[model samples]
Target chain A: MTSVVAQQIPYDSAAPYRSLSLNTATTKRWTLAEAVDGAARAGLGAIGLWRDRVDEVGATTAAKIVADAGLRVSSLCRGGFLTGREHGPAALDDNRRAIDDAATLRTRELVMVMGGIPDRDLAGARARVEERLALLVPYAAERGVRLALEPLHPMFCADRAVISTLAQALSMAEPHPSETVGVVVDTFHLWWDPTLADQIAQAGAAGRISSYQVCDWLNPMAPDPLLSRGMMGDGVIDFAAIGRWVRDAGYRGDVEVEIFNATVWSSDGHEVIETMKRRYRELVLPSLVG
Target chain B: MTSVVAQQIPYDSAAPYRSLSLNTATTKRWTLAEAVDGAARAGLGAIGLWRDRVDEVGATTAAKIVADAGLRVSSLCRGGFLTGREHGPAALDDNRRAIDDAATLRTRELVMVMGGIPDRDLAGARARVEERLALLVPYAAERGVRLALEPLHPMFCADRAVISTLAQALSMAEPHPSETVGVVVDTFHLWWDPTLADQIAQAGAAGRISSYQVCDWLNPMAPDPLLSRGMMGDGVIDFAAIGRWVRDAGYRGDVEVEIFNATVWSSDGHEVIETMKRRYRELVLPSLVG
Candidate 1:
């Protein structure tokens, strides 16, 4: 029998520069209050709260708990589902509510997953997203909330989001160039992008980059989409290289650890948060500091 | 019991402009000669031959058989694996052979699948691929062969191809800027690309668009990576819209049906070719024609 000793890599020791931010999905099994308190107890630097979690425990209370615990709010879970159909007006309304929540929480950024084709016509859906964003940008600007357009993986195109590349999202976010209308570069989504470095530079030059989320794309395929993401340093993505590029591109933002894994969420929140914090410190922080 | 009538879509009456170009993998069960005869029998307008198949049947003899059978050689099935450390020189040699074979068969384009990471470092692999392409571009130019860089799905980033987006590919092919070093806009690989239409437009504007390949992406996930492609109209992809976009972008190339499905390939070649021809005419051709 082959024994695999999965040891936790310590982040606080080697790379204090690497900051840990718990994406609420990491404790999806826990209540919003539980996640916030658990994240604080684990000594994570920050937390990324989801709209649903905030909604479950009133956003005001959630904000108070997070602040009381003295944890930084890195980013709000989401604010965009800019599909043409099913989620058009509803998505916009939801995003407005999300913006309000982020403002109350005092989060630095509101992550947006640009929803995919509403009626299976991708091009048409993309046009609609652009139009919707055009309307939403000014309102977001007014709220002082940055709309971080997060490009989802291409595999998520049909059901999740159509904006599957940093370059595409950057182009869409171009017309409404505001600190409010920046792009979120998630490693899980943008790691495979061939023009990742170039686009990161472009985003930096344009001052449209807002958030940097980290998660690894696991190999041999995982059965579930949400839970299959590998922890940092476990997969094929060159996170160190990406971290270096992001830094070079003038993104002095938080290196948020936003993993969406059901297994991790189902496990002890403290354990998951600690592991992520350690991995971020060891694998990702050194490159940034160097 | 569910009564399934198996929709009978006529091949010839579906679309006037819909032309079928069989990529030999659609009938891996059949020899290259068999595919040619079967394609001719099914009234397919064109066929994309593989280098191995040409080697199996002899390139000169395969050309004669295809010519005698009245089949247009749409494009050859690949000439690039320029990524791995040890395979660079060997890949170049194989590409030269492919170019020679394409020229012998009078095929207009040679599809190239960029290889992925050597040691699981995706960024390094992408840099290697770009370097190798730079080296091979002059040789491909001299041979008068258009090397169509096929940007594969990001899921294939670790094992198949590092180039995962049309935008990334266009940027890589930008510096060279020649008809000889163009791009292949394959529906399966590129359907999820958020910036597909824009990149296709860019490719067309640069006069670097060589081939357009069509195949559907299956949903509910496939167990096998290579053989899980769906038949046109059976999956989530809006092929009609993509076809129109490519056509509008000035890509006047054959819409080659390159399905790599074990189930389809295991079927009678006659039936497979006929069904593809029918679907192309009915579902794909009219959209582009208008």
Candidate 2:
């Protein structure tokens, strides 16, 4: 992967604050406190919090930890499994709790991954998601949180999220106010989409893009598809193109680096953050925030 | 998996000649002649040929064996790795040879799997696929063979086929005559598409459907994603729904079951065919050919 870290990059160094954020999942080995410290040490503008990490230190303490580190909470990792039939009530209740956590963490964006189908009824599951999202939308809005619908890659259509395109997320969010319901544009999940350019433009124009998650789609995907995301530039993603699209859409938000690869997780968390900055500056930010 | 096979099925058995087909990949342990004989013995109307098996016995004898068994060649497995710059000339030559073989086999359909992008340029790779297909159109037309564009699942967009949607396939085929250029409707690859119903209708209305391939998508996909395909009804694909879509679209064509699962490949080839027939009858044909 270091091969992608070339000898001569266009930019030798990034600015002190490039609106860069570190997602907790990228540093699997680090605790919430440690991740916050690492982000601050790396001079990141923000940090994306995973609920699991927040729960470990309690939401209030986690918020304090990030605030003390002087890093903004870019987004909450997740808050949606609304497609479950038997777990319907539990899922709804948990999402409310997640909204509470997001509110406590002081992050407006609560990334939602609509659950996959339990049975083969894809359309049915999707309808349930829509219905469930309607129920959660009001509650989330009450908490001043935006339930950011994350359109996972089509690969995860059956197991993770039935919603598989930025357009679908945008359409679902269309009924609600953009501030209450918005979309996440994750590079790993959306880079393969044929209509990505148009969809990115649409997302931007509609003022519905809530989160911008950066992670490259590994070419020879890891055995476990979930952990297949690589550090930016380590995979064959044209980050510059996608970054430019996001940038042109009039979004000046925190770009969260969220690598899910085992190798990235096993590496030194601090070093990974530095590498993330270098790669983001070298590849994506050049077109994005240049 | 047996849980899917209810004792009380809608149909006790399939019709004698149901236009059912068996792709060689399903019975990976079997040779071309074995697959043909197995398909014939199972009362299938056709058999989908893989180039590897055809190469094993040579195309002439392979064609003779299939003809001798009184089974039609449904379609050729593939012939379109036209994205490689280094292998561009060779890929075109090999595709022409595949067209020749398809003609010799007396099947009009040569399933073209548009190759993956070697770099991060998805748009560039897709353009090349469209361009390379243009070069093969006349050659295929002369031999009465149609280069059937197979839109692989988006998951394989990087390593397998860049054409990941039926709409994309149809767009690529729009510039060419339907008789010489066509689209493939594979349930496993296309079941996740939100616009599948409309695309199927479009493909059918345009008479662009060259093949209808079937295989279930396993939920907890296998370690080797390529070998993760499951038997019909054993996975989460709503075959009945897709079948009706194709049927309503006016595609009165052979239904080929092309699985690439290690378990299916390791199992008894004849038994797998029997299971495929039963599943097709119970799950797909109930709405498809009923």
Candidate 3:
């Protein structure tokens, strides 16, 4: 892997793949260094880092490696799970740490997967998220780390994340400054929303879109749809239409390709990067503005 | 099945199970006559009829059996796949026939599972549903049959129904008189909605809640979550919470038990009804008006 990494081609930020960023979760098996080098080799401008991968090498070292490789860290994978009752204080502390890490990595966005309901109280769980979010706003703003609320698909609302819509995420982000609080527009989770176009426009008008992540939603979703995300154009989603919505919204940020399928993970890391680049070009690049 | 029909216990309309109805899909293998008998034997006053079950014995014959068995048809299972562009006229004609069947069966509500996006044009498909619905309104009104739009869970947005929220269904119903066009509030399809309480209130205030179907959403969903619905108390849904919303919204309608899992269906039909009654009494009935 290191041999492959040393000989890798460096990404050109001013080229056609300028905005393409590889989210580490897309190739879950790669080490942080390998991912940075792989993204650079694929001519991808940036990479989205998951905390566990960053934690493996420590945030300070991970940041240096990416910077040395001439690649930007587009966004940290996540930092919010503020729905716990007994673990509320602990959850807040952990999120504070995530914010600190994002600051160190020099990434503006920290994606937040608001945790699921601890009990049967979905309303209460969401309320707690709002309460904790208010508390963290100042801390995040000071570090220039925007908390990007991600509304997972409704299927995970029971035991995963209660935030299930872009509108809900926007509402959660409304009171804070856009620089400190923003939303992630992930196609895999939100493409089914009937009001998607309107909401994307709203997110854009408010300057709250912190990141744009791309992945396909497979039908007959894997036993766990959580891992069913495929490469763009592999499923029923119209990436072109959704991509146009994100672009028209005035978002000139990194467009990350994030997938979680088991099959995609089993393939050689380099092969996966090649496929990701192809899918991004054919299915997504045409819809994005340079 | 016919032999059991004669010895079946008669349902008492004034009893606790007066508003309890059995959707034939719950006991998928049961014939129309058997379902009528099973519901009556279980002291359930009504049964929901699927078109195929009604077609098994002809709608007229099915209607007579339920009437003779002292049971009411709470609703006719379907009548709306109006999303097909090329088959627009055929879809409308089929829905017209379904309306006639609902009227013939003496059930006021005909549940409409609006078809999914025909192509990549979701907005256009939904527009087609609204257009065809306008054309069907007069005919449905003449027969005193209400077209009840059912918003299936978002998972089914691609291949099943594009209507994925109660609010969307209500919006579609807004143009017509409540008695002619209404919506079905099925727990399995809507348990994850954050604005449920408000929407239920809106549905009731507008007199647009045509039916209330109960079925729990499984967590580690079966291969097909479409058929993963469980008996009440078997899944994570807070039925007590959702049921209260429906009751407070001024709805005094049939509470239909509609399960679709293979495990439930493979059980003895009578045994399934017995379990359904027990679960309903424990998990859902208490939430309704005493």
Candidate 4:
């Protein structure tokens, strides 16, 4: 029975590539079906889904495609912009739609990019995130989805995420059940933080680490910082150290490669995946299993 | 005697303009002599000197120029870059020169920009900063100069400052006497920190507020993040709120305007000073007095 099962699976779960997952944004040119097929063919265990790509195929069809390819969804791209003035009935409805999609797609994690401040009142903007997140917590819990708060680098505090540190994200997640509200341990956004190791350990102890996103922080950040993330080995980020921190913190999950660089986006998706696999094996895998 | 002193001074010592200072980098075109004349002509009681500008006129002559113009040096631009691999006896010698220059210029605050990591070892680089900082503590103390640790924004962590937060700097400075080591409250670098208020209060209670530098954080940052600092009102920073925090923290010292925007640097120096005064009055003075 064991021999037959090994033959049928065609790959070992212990292999580094098996833990290597692709985030749809890395090969943004690929549609959901294409990403799913590519990830499966590359022997990846999972794929992180961005909302727009999932929307393109429809959540049900996207789920079917992943299931058919034997790949699970590692996480849902995002579901927060609570600080925007447009928040109202439409905002909650949109978040609920994301939660529903996460459940349908069979992913427990929803990455949250808290919106930037609408004005100079930074405190008020942060307060809104807390209030709105609390409102969405119960809804997310019912769907068995966790809102993984992603604290973007402080450089994005004005226009992307007001929550700019793991400490802040962890504090925000503490109020709700760890299963319902969690945090993302994204290397690119977090490597520079002085208190990250402690925070990651704290998150792990509380079981609040919902996603582990990997990418490099380019030394000379791109002109548009939103697209500054590079392939794991292309930037200055010390991935091995951060990887060790994450691994030691007790996280054993899909290691999703999520690059937002224009150069990577323009490259062939297969080649990009091949490079990611090699980089992951060289720079990150040791932290996990070594 | 009071009336005679007021007549000789030609301005009220308690006036807002009296505390307004011009950091020479804001007027990069000006020589030390020129900046001193410009600052004194603008009724600013103090001027922040950059090392390069001081080198041009020689520190002694520059000191005389400032004194002759009835202006004092508020703080020196920098005196730390101890983490560079090139650091050796020469690095300590250069820092000693800076300490000597600070004493000669009659300024006690020596802004210390902790150097960026030389390689991928962030923790190692930070340890080097701690080690080098300790070595220079007694040197600076002997000269009656306080090494004011300036935590640049994390965006500059790779090329500029490894010290990226007031909390980190405070922790690093904890072992030293508050008078020998201090921290800068620069709005441009610190406006986004959630714990800024508490840190500012901590710095104040410990009497570690060496300098309160003011500049706005530009929203769409320039390609070179180093030149992104803008005139206070020209950007999104809530100077009044931040200013109030500094003032309430017991910092009643000179408020220096230190912009590095290309536009500001190319503008007429006198006109720049006039605008700085207006913005400081409208945006920051209330925090100090109201």
TM-scores for the candidates:
0.85, 0.94, 0.92, 0.94
Q: Which DockQ-derived CAPRI band holds candidate 2?
A: medium
Clashing pairs in 2: none
State residue A40's C-alpha deviation in candidate 1, in Å.
Answer: 2.4
Ten-residue stretch with the least lDDT total in model 2 chain A: A1-10
lDDT of 3 by residue, B1-290 (tens): 01111112222334778778999999899888888989999988789999999998998898899999988788898988888877578788898899888888888889999988767677878888889899999998888888999999998887889899999999999999998899999998998888889999999999988899999877767877678899987887888899899988878778899999989988999999888888888788887754
Error of 1 at B131 (Å): 3.7
lDDT of 1 by residue, A1-290 (tens): 11111111233434363366778876778887788788777776677888888887787888888889877778888877777665457778888888888778887488888776656577778887888888787777776777888888887787778888888888888888557688988888888876688989999899888777888877755656555587887778787889888878877656677676666666777787778877887778877666
Chain A of candidate 1 gets a TM-score of: 0.90
TM-score result, candidate 1:
0.85
Measured over the true interface residues after superposition, the C-alpha RMSD of each candidate is 1.9, 0.9, 1.6, 1.1
lDDT of 1 by residue, B203-266 (tens): 8788877778888887645666566587897777887778778877876666778888767867
Task: Looking at model 1 chain A, report the run of 10 residues with the lowest lDDT sum.
Answer: A1-10
Q: What is the C-alpha RMSD, rounded to one decimal, of candidate 1?
A: 8.4
Q: B1-290, model 2: which lDDT tens digit per residue?
A: 00110011122233634578899989988999899899988888888999999999888899899989988888987899898756478889999889888888888888999889889989989888878889989888778888899998888999999888899899999999988899999988889888799999999999888888888999989988888789999899999899889888888778889999988877899899889988887788777755
lDDT of 2 by residue, A65-120 (tens): 98898888889979898887764788899999998888888888899999899999
Docking level of model 3: acceptable
Compare candidates 1 and 3 on lDDT and give the better one: 3
Give per-residue CA lDDT, model 3, range A1-290, as digits (tens).
00111111222334867678999998899999999999998887889999999999999999999989888888998887888886578889999999989888888888999888767677889998999999999888888788999999998887778899999999989999987899999988888888899999999999999899999877657876788899887887888889889878888788898999999999988898888888888888777753
